[model samples]
Target: MKYVVAWRERPTGSAAEYEAAQKRIREVLALWKMPASLTIHQFVARVGESGYAALETVEPADLQYLIAAFAPFSITVVPMMEVLDVAAGEPRGIEWRNGLPCTQP
Candidate 1:
């Protein structure tokens, strides 16, 4: 499965605090190694102190380690599905929902 991992640094009061947070995050990235279950496709940092990555992994649980490693920053893990997959499944999904025995007026 593919995933989009995003992160934003938590609010800091002063410049020194921001620097400390950055240093810690960098240290973690520098020391911690990627696990075998994950494949990083792309990584980029935006103008703000936020960044996101496009990653592919077989086991969803592998991402827990990543979130833990970046505990200093607010992080999110979102599963990605191809546009074609959503389009193909739309009809079946609608059919299944319509077939439900109960409906709301």
Candidate 2:
């Protein structure tokens, strides 16, 4: 499954504190060797915002580990299933049902 993991660094008392937080984040990633199951599509900081957004294709079983890897940062994980393929002209008539994609007759 694919997941979007968005995170924002928690506010800190000083620049030193923020730098420490960054260091911890890097350490955690290195410690885990950056999970082999995850295929990162995009990982970038949000411009004009103090946060980051990452899109990755990951196995469901590895999801928890992915979340835990972020450690102390405020993070949100959204499970996503592609229901449309604009390039392929898929789901010509589909709709969102209760926040999920569904085909319409």
Candidate 3:
């Protein structure tokens, strides 16, 4: 199973707050003994937006831990199972069914 984790700065959140949260998250990861299942990680920042986005592909079992790790910011977790190549008109890693791609459980 794979998960997509996204997080953005809270509307009322300040840079100091975000930095503090990141410090805690780093500490947690340092002391945490878990499998390295993350396959992809991306960070995005818009030119004018106050918030940023983080996208990741991780194992199902690690979803809960990631959510807890990013608790300081607004985040969303989505389970994804297939990667579709629209230009090639085919699925890259998993199959599609009923005109919709399957989601990870």
Best by lDDT: 1
Give the winner by lDDT: 2 or 3: 2
Report the error of model 2 at residue 18, Å: 2.5
lDDT of 3 by residue, 1-90 (tens): 545556665553778876776688678768866447655555565554433333443356566776676566577766654455343555
Candidate 1 regions exceeding 4 Å error are 100-105
| Candidate with more favorable, higher lDDT: 1 or 3 | 1
Residue 27 of model 2, lDDT score: 80
Please tell me which predicted candidate would have the highest TM-score against the true structure.
1
| TM-score of every model versus the real structure | 0.86, 0.60, 0.45
Query: In candidate 3, what residue range of length 10 has the lowest lDDT sum?
Result: 49-58
User: How does each model score on lDDT?
Assistant: 0.91, 0.68, 0.58
TM-score-wise, the better of 1 and 3 is 1
Ranking under lDDT, best-scoring first? 1, 2, 3
Structure candidate 2, residue pairs in collision? none
Candidate 2: residue 51 Cα off by (Å):
4.5
1-105, model 2: which lDDT tens digit per residue?
Answer: 677777777788998988898798778867675558778787787774445444565466566776676766777788765656443443443433345755776
